[model samples]
Structure formats: structure tokens, C-alpha cells
Target: MKYLVGVLLALIVFNASAQEEGGLKRPDIPGELMVDVGFNVWTSMPGGLERRTWSSKSIGIYYTKRKAFSSKLSFNYGIGLGLEKMSLGDSSTLASAVLDDNGTTSTDDDFVQSVLIVANPESFSKNKLATTYLDIPVEFRFHPLGTEDGEGLFIGAGGIVGLRLNAHTKWKYDNNGETVREKTSGKFNLNSFRYGYQIRAGFRGVHFFYKRYVSDVFKDPFPSGESPVMTTVGINVTGF
Candidate 1:
């Protein structure tokens, strides 16, 4: 991790130094920076998750660098951070601490799914499993009329490599007549590394993106029959 960061930083410094020694240069031919903001939808989920799943949503953003290759072509790449959540079907909150395996499910033939032994399931309005990541993004971009001018249509194809930041469960509920909320932070078997490819396109800096993590969502010893590898599709509203 440190090595990758060091190399990227070194390259950035070298580029900056070269530009300084060469005197002033055109911003368009030099480079452009951007940030991505969008949502995520999980695809190819296995059966185990379906039984307890509701709406799954994610939020993402990235900071990128685009170095022009011509009036219509460039290479875009950079780093950013993001967050995601998968809302389970059951309303019952997790019973265990951070990564404890004691968070037993509440479903039963005799007991209703709406009820729980660990938490008063009826009190909560929402409960979800969430995760975070630190990402490095890369793309090959084409700017139809060049970026030095005003707005233009742009397209890119590439991928990103992300390191898992953290994972947890969060919920908000009414205790008596008051609202109560809590968040548990831990790695619930998520892998340390995630990588995937994507395609991006947009007009005037507003872009849309789609990507799938090449790695699984969890590490070994995960509960059997749960395929949680995630596929994300979202938009990058603007850049700077």
C-alpha cells in the first residue's frame, strides 16, 4: 500500500517539476482533475442474502487526473473514497459487537421474522449492513472537442483498485417515544483488497459509471452459500 502511494506521489511530483522547469504551459494539454459522485446497486447476489435483503444502496466519489493525449483523447486516473450499504429484509438489529459471530438470525418456523430476542424489531424503521473503501481509479478518456474549451462529451474505460476501510451495521429506532440510533464498526469478514473494471461517460464533467469488484466481499470461513461480491453502477455528477 505504501509503495503504491509512494510511486504515485513521486510521479505527480516529477510531472509538476517538469512543467515548472519548462515554464508555463497550457492547462488543457497538461492535465485535468475530477471527482466522481454516484450510487451503487449490488448484482449477482446469492440466495442466502435474498431472504433477508431489502433495498441495497451505495454512495461513491473519486478524485482523478486526466492528461490529454490529443484534442479528443486523454488518460484519466486518481484516488477517492466511498461508502455502501445493504439493507437486510429482517428488521431485527444485529445482536453482537463489531465482528462477533454471535449475531444469530431471528427467523424460525414457530417465531415470526418481525420479532427478535436481541432487539425490539418493531421499534426500528431501518437497519443495514455497511462498508467503506479507499479507492485508486484509472481510465482512458476521449473528449470530443477538447477540454480546454467549455462543455463537451467525454468517454472513458478503465478500472479501480480499492482497499477495504471498514464494515459495520447501523440502525435507527424509536425507544419509547424517542429516537435511538447506533452504529457498529468492524470488518465483518470483508477482504482487505478489492479491484474491478468499469466504463465511464458524461457531458460537461457530469459522468456515469459501472464497475464490479473482482474480489469476493468476504474472506475465507464466511458462512456457506453466500456470494456477496458486489457490482456497482452510478454517476459522477461533476468534476474539479
Candidate 2:
């Protein structure tokens, strides 16, 4: 969190200085490069699927093009890469149910289709799940003062869609005083696509953003109602 705050402050200061020096003139380029850093949380998480709030983080990088509808309103669209890490709490790890030769199962009793099993904390030093995605985002922005020079108060509402690129679980444990790090990669019944809504508001190039995904994180065997919904809130820094 401290690192995020420092970056926000630096971006704000740099943007303010640039505006002062350039005197409100719009940049030659109409596109902006944005970086997002945030904390991830799960809503309606199933029992035993607890997350370590501060350790679960998200990062995204995007290049967006803006089209002005008016001095105070504009449309923007972008493509980006997003990375997320979810560190489980209470020394828990994600596990997938085994399917028989017929690829069918009769195990719907679990609260979460993707099961989370608790292990002794002292037995493991690290445990986490990570995912990567290719993302596209669209937004309609309202800049109260004007869109030129990217100054003053601006508010935007947008939707984002992401295609899963990779997902995996990692663990580190001690084996007779020898540390062993293991990583397992699999589909894990995770959804191939995810969609979410976001709202952003701020001054100049630094903004606060809140995003929530309404779709379930898993598919098929994983019950939709029992799947986790992801939420992120954080700082966005934009540069031209």
C-alpha cells in the first residue's frame, strides 16, 4: 500500500508540473498509457477459501485512445494485460476434484466447486494462486472542466472483458530441512472469460478506481452460485 501511495504522489506531482509548464495545451498524442495497482478481494467466498487481503494483488497496463464527443465528454477504449495473485489464508490451498474415466462425477456437496483444503501453516512457507489475462476496456468519461491537457476533475464508468491466458497454483514447503517449491498448472475449471464494471474519478493523471466482476470465476462442475466474484480497488496512473 505504501508503494502504491508513493507512485500516486509521484505521478500527481509530475503531472502538475507538466501542466504548469505547458499552460493547458493538449498533448500531440490523443492516447494515454495507464498503469493500475490494486488489492484483490473475493466476495461471497466459499468456506475454507479465505484470502490474505493485503497479499492478494492485481496489476494492469493499458494503452487507451480517446475520442471527444464534446469538450467535457469523451469515449475511450483500450487493450491491456492484467496479472493477479491470490494468497490463501490459514495455510489453505486450492484443489480440484478428480474425475473418473467417463469424465463425470457426483460430488456437488462441496460449498465451492473448486475445493480449498486447509493444511498446517507450519508445514508450508508459501501458497498462492495466480492468473494472467488479456483485457479490453471501454469507458465513457466526463471531464467537468475540459478534456484538453488532462486536467481538473474527471469521472469515468467503464466495462472490461478479459480472456484467461494462464492459471496456476504454487507452493513452497520444507522437506527434511530442504526447501521444495512446486508449481502446478491446470485449467482448474476456471472460467475462460471474465467481464467486469469499473468506476474511476480523480484529478489529472492520477485516479482512484473501483472494479467488480459479476461473472463467476469458475465454470461447469464448479457451481456458479458458489464461485467467487472478484473485486479490486486501487490507484491508476495515466501518462501520455
Q: What is the TM-score of each candidate against the true structure?
A: 0.65, 0.76
Q: Each prediction's Cα lDDT score?
A: 0.61, 0.76
Give the TM-score comparing model 1 with the true structure, all chains together: 0.65
Clashing pairs in 1: 52-89
Total backbone clashes of model 1? 1
The candidate that achieves the highest TM-score relative to the unseen native structure: 2
Local error of candidate 2 at residue 11 (angstroms): 16
Q: Write the per-residue lDDT of candidate 2 for residues 5-70, one digit (tens) a residue.
A: 564586567566657453754345657778888988877655456677788999887778878888
